[model samples]
Target chain A: MDEKDKEILRMMQDDFPIVPKPYKRIGDFLWMDEVSVISRVVKMMQDGKIRYVGPYFNSAKLGYSGQLMAINVPEDKIEAAANAINKYDEITHNYLRAGEPNIWFTLMTPNEKRAEEIIEAIKKELAIDEILSFKSKKTFKIKVNPA
Target chain B: MKIIDERTEKVLKEFQNNFKIETRPFKRIAVKTGLTEEEVIAIIAKAKEDGIIRRVGIGVRPALTGFGMNALTAWSVPPDKVDSFGEAAAEIQNISHCYDRECPEGWIYNIFTMIHASDREELENIIKSLSERFPECPYKVMETLKELKKTSMKYFK
Candidate 1:
């Protein structure tokens, strides 16, 4: 990505226009044409640099409870556990980190009861004994501005 | 207030991630939601104003942008020191996400911060700077071995 592309990314992260011609607004700000701005964004998306340009909805305000969960799955059962965890649409991020709790995932359910039910079901199916769930007591910062 | 009418649901489902990246993008969303471009813009604006939509923006991968080295650095702060720890960690720009999480049984790490840097040495330095502030609390860096599944949450589906 060139400097112009980086500039576009920096601006978009802070404030992406919500109007009909959002790209034009960005182009005007960056001193580039609308077509050039759109093409560059498209190229970045195709190159896997930019995931997508979309709205990030607040799941909490949408009445969803979120939790961070870590499970200590045996090496032999890692694949099975991952497959099982990925089946649930409610689980947004599932990762294999280097630690005792090898498998970590984030769960967002419509309510706390639903989240518990899913966790219980996973434990029963996989026979997982060592697990930990960390619910956010307070959020100090959550900003993504990478260019 | 939470406003999830039928039309709003349709709009969200269509443009959550698959937003059109062209001129008059909202027009396409309007077509999908059976509303005019103006109505679609109004819906998004209201959602943003209501704190339901955090931002209409792009998700840039730090790995591709030379900030690939990232990990969840969980700190074992004392019960009384979590608030101060969070405030101190929040001031640093490298720490994108810092939160006070509920500490369950068998785990002592109560505060988690996602630290990102261009290299391992840089990451260690960032950790060192933070640890200097609270020498009493220990920390652990759980490096990500692999991403099993990472995707945006699809609501109103």
Candidate 2:
């Protein structure tokens, strides 16, 4: 990734253009051509530097409730618990961090009741109740783009 | 305002599962949704205006960009000051996601901020700076060990 690539990434931080010729807009901004811009994006994806260029939806706006839960798992069983949590599509992100209550995952459900249902199911399946769900009191920063 | 028509739902579904990575990507999505290219753009614009869709960009890995190191740092702030502190943390470039979570029993730290840095020293410095800035709030750090999954939630499924 060179300076030009960073510039492309920085531009990409904006929602990709919704136009038919989206690459053309990016090329115009960077003083390059459409082919080069599209090629670079493809390269970035191939290199594991990017997953994709897409829109980020707001769950709350879509009438869904989201929560960040930290689950207490024995080091030996962390992977199992993570696997179990990943089974549900409601769980968007799952991570293993350093510390007790180490397994972390975020859940986005259609409503508050649905959120409870998923959590209850996990509790029963995992046979654990020492879980803490951090409901969003407020969202300070919703967009954190790496450019 | 949270109403989604069949057409809008179809468009959001396309974005969730398939974000075409080609030039004239919207043209492809337009065909799938049976909307014109212009209509697709207009809907996206309206969604952006409504704050439903945050941003459009390459979903890149931060670690690849040299900001790989990440830690979930929690600060125990007075309930009333959490809002202001959260706002302050959000202003810092390194602190990406900041939130005030419910304090469970035995968990005193209520405010959490995710810090992403390239190295341990940089992350420590940010934590130190944050501590000094919010000295009243005692804090703890949990460095991220491994990423199990990092995909966006697919809605309208």
Q: Model 2 residue A112 lDDT?
A: 80
Give stretches of model 2 more than 4 Å off: none
lDDT of each residue in B25-49, candidate 2, tens digit only: 8877789999988898888888888
Per-model TM values vs. the true structure: 0.93, 0.95
Backbone clash total, candidate 2:
2
In model 1, residue pairs whose N, Cα or C atoms come closer than 3 Å (at least 3 residues apart or on different chains), thus clashing, are: none
- Alpha-carbon local distance difference test for all models: 0.85, 0.83
lDDT for each residue of candidate 1 in B3-39, tens digit (9 for 90 to 100)? 5777777777777845878888889989877899999
lDDT of 1 at A94: 90
Tens-digit per-residue lDDT, A83-105, candidate 1: 98999999988988888888889
TM-score of 1: 0.93
Against the true two-chain complex, what DockQ does each candidate achieve?
0.74, 0.74
Tens-place lDDT digits, model 2, residues A1-147: 998888888888866777779889989999999999989889989999887678888778887777889888878887789888898889988889888778888998887888888888889889986579888777887666532
Interface RMSD, one decimal, each candidate: 1.8, 1.6
